[model samples]
Target chain A: MQQITTEGNQERMQRLVAVRPRLISFARLQLRDLARAEDAVQEAIEAAIEKDDTFAGRSGYETWVFGILKYKILDSLRAQRREGWWQPLDEELDEAAIDRQFQKNGRWDQEARPSDWGDPETTLHSERFWKIFDLCMTALPDTAARVFSLRELMGLSTEDICRETGLKQNNCWVILHRARLRLRACIERDWLAEEA
Target chain B: MFKMMMCKEATHLMSKRLDVPLTFQEKLSLKVHLAMCSYCTQCNQQFSLLHETGKQYEKLIERDIVTLSSGSGDSR
Candidate 1:
């Protein structure tokens, strides 16, 4: 753990204050409740400040603080689940709707054909793409969005997600599959279609 | 005919690979489908792009923190 000198403590305090807004925004993306998001961020920052010595400086301060915030968000989610305030993701994807994307023999329909996306990493620098990306992410069903965020954004594994969200393995896989399908379609329609 | 997988099923396997390990037969089936079907291949590519975009977005968010902290520091 890194030693927090008096001067370092003051600097860290200011840095934490600056990062708080971003932390709250992240929490809001997961929690979907503004007041609850704020509360989670507040608790995370307080815990970090109180446990300043626990930061080993192996990671950047912001990264370390965000790690703390991730746990806080999970705690809040678990508490919400325990209190019966959490809603399961909508899993009843319409079979007809899904089948419509395929032909009688299961080949892809013409309309369902995905075009080759050449070097998608090129678009990451585009601010407009991120805006559309954010919209597509937020438009996902609440639980689906959280699952995607935890798995993709936070880089959590499937087992970790099941543990964190109290989801069964099969259910977790189904939710992620549906979420990916929706997100890919949404981006293609709202973002990629526009750029063409 | 029994061994043949549909595009829907292939897509499901493609997505599943991201979350869990597919059995040898499952992987072989998806591979065969991708080989014969341009559409599923493109779909797989699109999913890859989404995963790439997500990782890049996280880095972008991290960079934004430096930008935020370097500014007047009072801006929320």
Candidate 2:
């Protein structure tokens, strides 16, 4: 029994090392700082190793490890919030770009109107489409990308997002709106327009 | 002329709805606008699709992590 337990621990450690890159990428998406993301993933892996005995096999090992990493990422986010590590850059410029989509009458500009994306659902299954989507996500302005990821990708509530980003509730909503609009336009232009 | 919901406002409401519950007036105006505006209606569908894409993207990340870890043979 002791020998069996030792082998299990050894296997777990190997698995942890193998999963490190994936954890780093996941953290990078949320933290948006490579060093911080690497730090968070490292901390989580260390914690996982220390607490290996407590890990029940109820879920897949990767899922369980991800749960721990999620907390580490959130803690890093909270620390950044307390430190005022980032400020929304060129916010007025971003807002102005969004406004350009509409005319003085508040209707869409002829050139800015959303085009019909025939069967967007079908694109979800296309790996190339997701590659375009990732490019569009990366193209978002810094603050807008972070806020949108927290609210949409991470499934954080708007209030939690406002607290994390030190933005007011209305500002959070506006950023999310801008992210969606930009992402929509980017995907349309890069993916759909290219196809045509 | 009565103030009607413009496409800009309608699209904003559509995107905002994905994040939060809209107020009654906001919901009503959005509904009214979407009914008359085919463009806004299409925009609404795309907004929801975008939300779904976000969820799917998360799953994809998780799946990739699992595949990467398992696909790599034991490297001590």
Candidate 3:
């Protein structure tokens, strides 16, 4: 029985190490800070190892590990919000940029109009397309990216996002709108244009 | 003179609808604008596509992690 437990622990440690990079990627996307993401993933790994004996078999090991990391990421986000680390400095600038996409008559400016992306499902399947998608996500102003991820990737409602980030409802909507515009334009320029 | 909804407002409504339900009036205006303006119509579709892509990206990462970790000899 002792030998069996020792082998199980060894296997668990190996699995944890194997999944570390993906965990870091997930954390970085959510936290947007590499060092902090690394710290959270490390802490999660340590916790998983320490609690190996008590792990309930209800969930897959990877899912269980991700659950711990998600809490860690949330803790870091709460801490950042409390510290007021992200100011809304560039929000007006973003609004101005969005306005430029339209003409004086409120029609889409010829140069800024969104083009037909013909079969976006095909693009979703392309590995290279996702690379451009990741670049576009990274290019967003930090706060916009965070709000976008919380609303879309994390599946939080607008109200919850506003509560979490201390943003007003209107402000949250504006940020999400800008994020969608920028991502659409970026993908068109980088991926769709190349295909044509 | 019938006031036509501009692409700017139409696009904002498109993005906003993804996060929250649009009021009946907002939905009617958006429907009218989209029928008249093909550009905003396309943009609206792209917004929904982007939302789906974000969801798929999340799943992709989770799938990768699961596959990597499960490569070990542990059977579950």
Candidate 4:
């Protein structure tokens, strides 16, 4: 009937509006680029429009849409995997090639300004803070890096991260421990060296 | 040796709970360990810093959600 079709189109448009920003951030997290993330999310919205009926109301609408986006991410990664161009996050983190995080003999370089790194409590949003955080996070081992990002950056719980990552609970704790240690060291060598 | 590890683990777990005060036995063992190991001292500091940082970051990220959407729940 006309009523059902009208309702469907209206609801579909609303879902699009609801899921937009989250989809942008989700894809951005996976792809690490804003444009690519926007493209993937737009593509996902188009797909979700066609399959709206398949969304059985078993879970949240955003979660269901993200499931679709996960497929897109996997597809993108698979294409890269086939091309042999996709590098693991762990292997791709090159300390030497990257702007030289630490000065020679483990001293903190003073050029970037040491006083600013003092309070993570206040300087959390500072460019240098995020830059150092990202570098140190990438320095973590692959599984640990993924776990930390999922738990911290993506705001996933241990149970959710475990399910998505296929890691055991105890393994999750170990990964978290390693991430914390590596991040602490990274901050010490690169960010906090001046004070030390 | 295994029993000692188990006892130490249990005591550490007990220490982690906010509600439970360490018994005299655990308190004594902890004092002895802290007296001997600076690594534990560093770990305690790191754990406190990390916990506080995690709580604050979660709050900040929660606030970062875009709430100015024009559409309400009924907009669909």
Best lDDT goes to which candidate?
Answer: 3
- Candidate 1 residue pairs in clash (backbone atoms < 3 Å): none
- Give the runs in model 2 whose Cα sits over 4 Å from its true position: A1-22, A82-84, A88-91, A118-121, B65-76
Best by TM-score: 3
Cα lDDT tens digits, model 3, A1-196, are: 3334576677667767777886787677778888988999999998888778778455566667777887788788887777876554336467766777889888998988888887877867677877787788888888888888888776778898877877898988988999888888887788767787
Worst 10 residues of 3 chain B by lDDT: B53-62
Provide candidate 2's TM-score on chain A: 0.79
Tell me how far the alpha carbon of residue B28 in candidate 1 is from the true structure, in angstroms, after superposition: 1.6
Error of 3 at B24 (Å): 0.8
DockQ, prediction 2: 0.49
Better model by TM-score: candidate 1 vs candidate 4: 1
Q: Candidate 2: how close is chain B to the reference, as a TM-score? A: 0.72
After superposing candidate 1, which stretches have Cα over 4 Å from the reference? A1-5, A93-97, B52-54, B68-76
Q: For residues A114-184, write the lDDT of model 4, one tens digit per residue.
A: 23234446656554654566566555655566555566554557777666655676566555654554555
Residue runs of model 4 more than 4 Å from their true location after superposition: A1-120, A194-196, B1-76
Tens digits of per-residue lDDT for model 1 on A1-196?
Answer: 5544675566677777876776776787778788989999999998888887777355677767777887888889888888878866546553455566778987878886677655666766777776777788788877888888888766789899888877787888888777777777777776667778
Clashes of each: 0, 0, 0, 0
Provide chain B's TM-score, model 3: 0.74
Per-prediction TM-score: 0.82, 0.81, 0.83, 0.44
A47-162 per-residue lDDT for model 2 (tens digits):
88777788845556666777788789889988886788867542635877778878988888877777787776677767777778778877788888888878766678989877
Candidate 2: interface RMSD equals 2.9
**TM-score of decoy 3:** 0.83
**Order of models, best DockQ first:** 3, 1, 2, 4
What does candidate 1's lDDT look like per residue over B1-76, in tens digits? 5578888888899889988889999999999989998888878987777667545745665776677566745442
